[model samples]
Target chain A: METRNLTCINCPMGCQLTVVTDGGEVVSVTGNTCPRGEIYARKEVTHPTRIVTSTVSVSGGVIPVVSVKTASDIPKESIQAVMDAVSGVCVNAPVSIGDVLLENIAGTGAALVATKNVAAKQL
Target chain B: MNKAGLSYYDIVIIGGGPAGLAAAISAKESGADSILVLERDRELGGILNQCIHNGFGLHTFKEELTGPEYAARFISRFHELGIDCRLNTMVLDLKAEAPSGDEGSSNGCIKTITYSSRSEGLVQITAGAVILAMGCRERPRGALNTPGYRPAGIYTAGTAQRLVNIEGCMPGRRVVILGSGDIGLIMARRMTLEGAKVLAVAEVMPYSGGLKRNIVQCLDDYGIPLLLSHTVTEIKGKERVEAVVISEVDENRRPVPGTEKEYECDTLLLSVGLLPENELSRGAGVGISPVTSGPVVSESLETSVPGVFACGNVLHVHDLVDYVSEEAAAAGKRAAEYIKGGASAGSDTPCVPVKTGNGVRYTVPSYIHPDKAGERITLRFRVGDVYRDCAICVYLNDSRIARKKARILAPGEMQEVILSGDELRSFPDLTEIKVCIEAN
Candidate 1:
């Protein structure tokens, strides 16, 4: 059995969880207080993905640009490639909230969208 | 035409989070004839809803509970007390209605609060006191200036937490967490358990910023590597997150040369820090502490503005929800007193601002009025870094007012030292207060 120590971040308890795995599958899980910990552990041993948030350059804005984020989750390994595609891209000012930056970015099924609007920079 | 306008309440709290909810309950219990709570979210519970893990309510409830459970305990009590809570309602603005003392009151103080709701369309209410409890927001990726091609797989820990716990969505397959705060450590274990390989939890600090228990349980137990004094210096990806360059930092927190290591991963989670949500507080003209980024309160938890009180994470970031509830209870009790005209009499003697000294990061209850009889001052603050066998000394100029020995101290955790009203009486002519950590 492969014993793994896990940290429970679901709350501040930060409980150390011990997950015992057999044959590359979770055999028994211990040391988690909430179901989220067990879920976290099981997923850690399996699949994981992350939500991405970043900023895009906006021409003619007061703050130089505004912040943006992926409205949906994306593949874990594809984040670097996705961010690279977003790096060179610049949106014009007057972008509205929820405006799409990139639809189906890198074919990851996650759309990069604007979280806030930067009105065209005043001369 | 006798047009009946919206009725006014004794107190109106915005943001229905722990701070707002606790303030409402305290206002009612303190004899505020009417109180209202406006929450923008669909439900009353704030960020607590997404926090499904336990370790809450130990101090206030004397039992361990999850985030929802802790919030539920207060929410249920709020309902039991018949506090008016309007969910799915957003407060747009707070305006001073009139000058103090013009309306036959000793001080002319009135607030006009505008709000909107699906059921009520547009509505306005007036109140004598307003409490700002909007809480704080997480630091995002750009704030760190992490050199990288813009990437897809980076997320704030809170966002990922919400997606996983509330929406039942996976965030990534192979995860690497930045800044070993509690969230990142927890997520390291969380993603790992969900069948994701957490490459490492990298922190720039020499010592782990998260709780000691987290280091043991989250990273050590899971065999997830914790690279201390290291940081993700660069993000390498063309279209998505491919790999990251991790580098070690010296004591000054500057990256060292020739120690760069590369880790291939698809995702990065940032749990760097939390900043107090002070936009509404600033708009309301409340004095904010530069260090804590929350309101500067006296012993009674009353903000610089009279009748305005704050509590919970809105007041300052608390390490535990139990402490939040406890602090909120105090704010609530004080708000109730203020409404009942029972607040501590104003002091003619100028209040002295407390400063943090060696080994201390910051101190709360920024000012103390010695004349405020019956007030027990609880000073909450944090240390600079990890320490062993240290003593926390509260000093008035050169004279020490209070001192306590601590077995261990961590900057990630807040510490509290309570001074009873009787004890404060001894230092009546206080000019200054200082909290310092010294070797035990």
Candidate 2:
């Protein structure tokens, strides 16, 4: 059995989590104030994941860029590829929050959606 | 201020950030019909608009959200509640009016807010209650007093955030961030993601002021070195940034004679500290604490000037926006109650002073009004230094009333102790309470 420690990012509490694994299988989890922390630890030690946030160019918008993030947490190792995909992306103005910009972003199975609203520039 | 330009609002929130938005929503829910939110920016959401990062809305919404998503939730809610707001409005002055001025007088004063809007020009509004949620601003290079010539490439972390996330413009390709505050650490990653090389993050304090997770994900993940007990001593640049001289400091935080290294970088970002924007608070005659550099608020979040309340970063710099929203909602509710109650605390009200004990730095709601402090009041404070395996103790007068065990405590992180009003009401002669940290 092996044990590892991780910080729960579910909330601002950032609860410290401890997970023990038995030969690549689940054993037990502790030191979490909430159940989500335990769930996070179990997945984190197995297949780590992260939500990637970035900005994409907006054409003819009130602002030059609109902030975006993955619709859900993607595999941690795929963050760089997702960013690389995001770098070449651009969308039209009047982007609303939750608007999907890239489907299956970087082939990570998570959609990249706009997080901020960007109004179209008035002529 | 002309009479024709005078408007009326039951409550006027000074800023339309997360704090102000939450306050306006709760105020409307609390039955204040006329509430106005003033935002200086082109739109609402304040700094959150520029903050595109995830890891927000954990407590309030129970889901990890990006900054804009978190703000959009509140913005939608605020809109659903039919709250009124003026965008591109800058509040120029806040003043207390109609003070009785007599000793021991409890006739709470009215508040007047003067603001300039791009559409409406300068306007003065009479407010039955004012909630200060102007938030805070980052400390500039002048605050650090570092030996440097004025250069164009130096920007505050927040400024860089806006430039990158909002304007889609990169500040520079090579960056050296000063101070390991969360903003600086986050920006180190942001600059990196935007294709800039973040050389290092230097903090004067031994420990990073940012959250442990930020240190891990932002700096450690990117392989960016965090130089603890070090700071940028000199800026060697003229027109644009050329380089920054980093030096180690001793126990007194004074630069050591021989330990210095130079980093060739085009941009320098400062995240040294944040100061609560208090010029408006001071103009309103709110008693400011030298420690928090914020208003001395009571349990009801009421400032020294009656009918005026403060919350969010304006009250004290909170690490979490969730806490700010929680506090602002309370302030809004209290302001609504103040309007409904229509009476001020007289000379008979209890002024229970809440003081800091060993290891505690300062606390909000410095005074607790036993009668008015709802069912539970969360006393938030920061510690003076780091501690492990410690206990937080609350002493009423001389008797220790409550104690909670803490695994660890740090100056960078804000801590809280919940006190029940019933507990305080039980103590009839309670004069003061002190919160302290004890080694376990």
Candidate 3:
């Protein structure tokens, strides 16, 4: 059995969570303020994931770049691969906020979509 | 319009960031017709445009949203209201109209603002009420007075954020962050995600100035070392930042002689602190709080200058954008009420000053008029240091009025207490109101 200490990120309250895992399975979770914290702790101890956010260069856009983020949380370990794939890809201008730039990025099953609108530069 | 070709607005908000946008929306909703927002940037949304990270709008919208998404919600609402605004307009100065009486210009009945843009040359405008929402700016390397030659590699965390997220440019590959402020911690993760190596983050204080969640996700998740009680002692380079000397800091925050260690790096990111950008407030003759470095306000979010209100970072640095929006919306509603000739300071009621003691640094709306406050008033303040298992106590004179248990209180997180107006009214003979922290 192993114990892990974590801070709950579900809210700004940042409740400190203590979890005990047995054979790679969450046995007990304590020190959480709410049920959401318990669920977060169980997943966090077993498989940690994060939503990767970054910017992609845009050709012929008003601004040089448009911000992008994965459609869903990807495995923490695949963050680098997702970033590497997104960095090498650039889309043309007139991109909307929800435009998907890369589908199934790094095989994480999460599409990378633009978070900001980049209007086309007037000629 | 005055002889200076001044246009007129019922409410003129100084910034178009989250604060200003929320303020304008509330002001218009409260029945103020002639509302105008002045944005210095080419577009709206202010700094949120460059902040692409999530974890925002959780409090306000009850869901996680990226910075731009959160900002776009307000922008769309602002447009829906048909509120007028000037983009790419930079405000130059704020001036009081000088009410003729010894009562002082604190209740600046009429105020003038000067701004300039490409399409419009320098222009002046008069407002019935002004909401200062200019927000705060990050402290640069010059503010630290670190011994170093001006190099090409050093950048404030915020400036670097704009470069990476907006301009799509990288500041450097190998990085040594000077402080563990939220922006610095976020940048530590950002640079690494962008394929740059973040060497380490050094904080002068014993405790991190950022949120505990950020410390875990941004640094610990990425295996970045956070050196607490440490600061950059010297910058070693001629043309660019070749290296920096990190030294452990004593309790006095002074560098220890033998604790100096060198790290080879090409870039340095400073996130020491944020100061409320209150130059315009000072120019308008608003009373400034030495502790907050922001305007001294009343319970209604009205500044010393009555009709002129302040909120967001211009009043005091807020840790969350949701709080900024919340505070600013109150400022907007109050400004609209003030414009309607309601809640005028001409009443005979005296403004009661709320005193701070024992670990509390300062409180916004330092003064309160008991009757003017609605059902309850929320007083927000920051602690001077890290505290654990303490109670936030509110006192009416020497008597304990309220006590709430606090699990943790840190300088990085803001603390707030709600004072019931009915309770204050019950103590009609109350002489002093104080807030302090006590060991539980």
* lDDT (tens digit, per residue) of candidate 3 on B229-272: 99999998989999999999999999999999999999999989
What candidate 2 gets wrong by more than 4 Å, as runs, is A1-42, B1-5, B99-108
**TM-score (chain A only) of candidate 2:** 0.87
Question: Which candidate leads the pack in lDDT?
Answer: 3
TM-scores, in order shown? 0.76, 0.94, 0.97
Tell me the spans in candidate 1 whose CA falls farther than 4 Å from its real position. Answer: A1-123, B1-6, B96-107, B344-350, B373-375
- Candidate 2: Cα lDDT at A109: 91
lDDT of 2 by residue, B377-411 (tens): 99999998988889999999999988898877888
Best by TM-score: 3
Residue B209 in model 1: shift from native, Å?
A: 1.7
Better of 1 and 3 by lDDT: 3
TM-score of 3: 0.97
Per-residue lDDT for B15-47 in model 1, tens only?
887778777777777777688899998767698
Q: Score candidate 2 by lDDT.
A: 0.89
TM-score of chain A of each: 0.84, 0.87, 0.97
Clashing residue pairs, backbone N/CA/C < 3 A, model 3? B106-B305, B106-B306, B107-B306
The TM-score of predicted model 2 comes to 0.94
For candidate 3, the lDDT comes to: 0.90
List per-candidate RMSD values in Å. Answer: 11.9, 2.6, 1.8
| DockQ leaderboard ranking | 3, 2, 1
